[model samples]
Target: MNNETTNSFIVQIEQKQLLLTALWPMRFEQVQQCKSWFAQSAVKAGTLAYGADRVELGLSFANESFTFCYEDYSESFWVTADSAGGAMLLSELAKEFSSLEIR
Candidate 1:
């Protein structure tokens, strides 16, 4: 990761809107896999909506929460984390997927 990407991850203490990408565009199956990962993480109040070109995911964990929109065309994930815990959760997510880029 570049300095900008690394710094952004550290500088954003509270709410952050991040664009997550991989080497290739993500498919619907990949999105489903992500959802399953969240479920395994014990997220609360989770919801998932699938569309032809996108998938939306919302999850809450105690005081931390995040929402994600995966765009198939761009193979990117738009993520918003609203709290410190949420930010930490996002960090954990990035660790889980080594190919994920936080930008």
Candidate 2:
């Protein structure tokens, strides 16, 4: 990771906020997974939308113009942009999606 390409981001959902950090080596892959997660999770959380594949993820919340997609070759599960809100929504839906449990 180099100083120029590394980036940090913050996502706010309602009153909660989350911080995310990424670097060049995995930025593209991370962005893709984040978008995919946002699309699927958002839909599941009742934030229904027509296009999941077209959703975009960003490394910075300041600018919102980056396009993202899933990269099957990635090795991690990362979320981005609206993830804070998406996480809260998903957390609320988890109770309804309860098919299994752990102790």
Candidate 3:
């Protein structure tokens, strides 16, 4: 059972109190290619969140809320939601793949 997270992004818009994220193994190049598609998906999903190359999700009554961004150097993607408080909802939004932890 491999349980390591990849493909993550942090969607943050604190100025609006809306936070969202994703935890999937989406490569930086991949994200770069599908920026428009991701943005449109959020809109279609009714999140209405936007960014230059990322997607932001608004806080929803269902308890999932987040805003995301990318860090190219570390190849790190993050999702920030209060988890125990349904923040994981944001985490769930990610389309990810699983891999064994390399230690």
In model 1, state the lDDT of residue 25.
47
Question: What is residue 30's positional error in candidate 3, in angstroms?
Answer: 4.5
Give per-residue lDDT, candidate 1, residue 98.
Answer: 43
Higher-ranked by TM-score: 1 or 3 = 1
Ten-residue stretch with the least lDDT total in model 3: 94-103
Scored against the true structure, residue 77 in model 2 reaches a CA lDDT of 23
Model-by-model lDDT, in order? 0.57, 0.29, 0.38
Q: Write the number of the candidate with greater lDDT, choosing between 1 and 3.
A: 1
lDDT of 2 at 52: 30
Q: Candidate 3: where are CA atoms >4 Å away?
A: 1-63, 82-84, 88-91, 94-103
Whole-model alpha-carbon lDDT for candidate 1: 0.57
Deviation in Å, model 1, residue 41 alpha carbon: 2.6
* lDDT for each residue of candidate 2 in 7-102, tens digit (9 for 90 to 100): 232222222322222322444423434423433232222222223333233422222221222333442222332544444443333222122111
Q: Which run of 10 residues does model 2 get worst, by summed lDDT?
A: 1-10
lDDT of 3 by residue, 1-103 (tens): 1123343333443322223245455555554543344432332223434345454333332544444444555444444443445444432343321221211
- Candidate 1 C-alpha lDDT tens digits along 6-76: 31132122236556544444557767656665433445537788888888887675557778677877766
Full candidate order by TM-score, most accurate first: 1, 3, 2
Model 1: colliding residue pairs: none
Q: Which of 1 and 2 is ahead in lDDT? A: 1
> What is the lDDT for 27 in model 2?
44
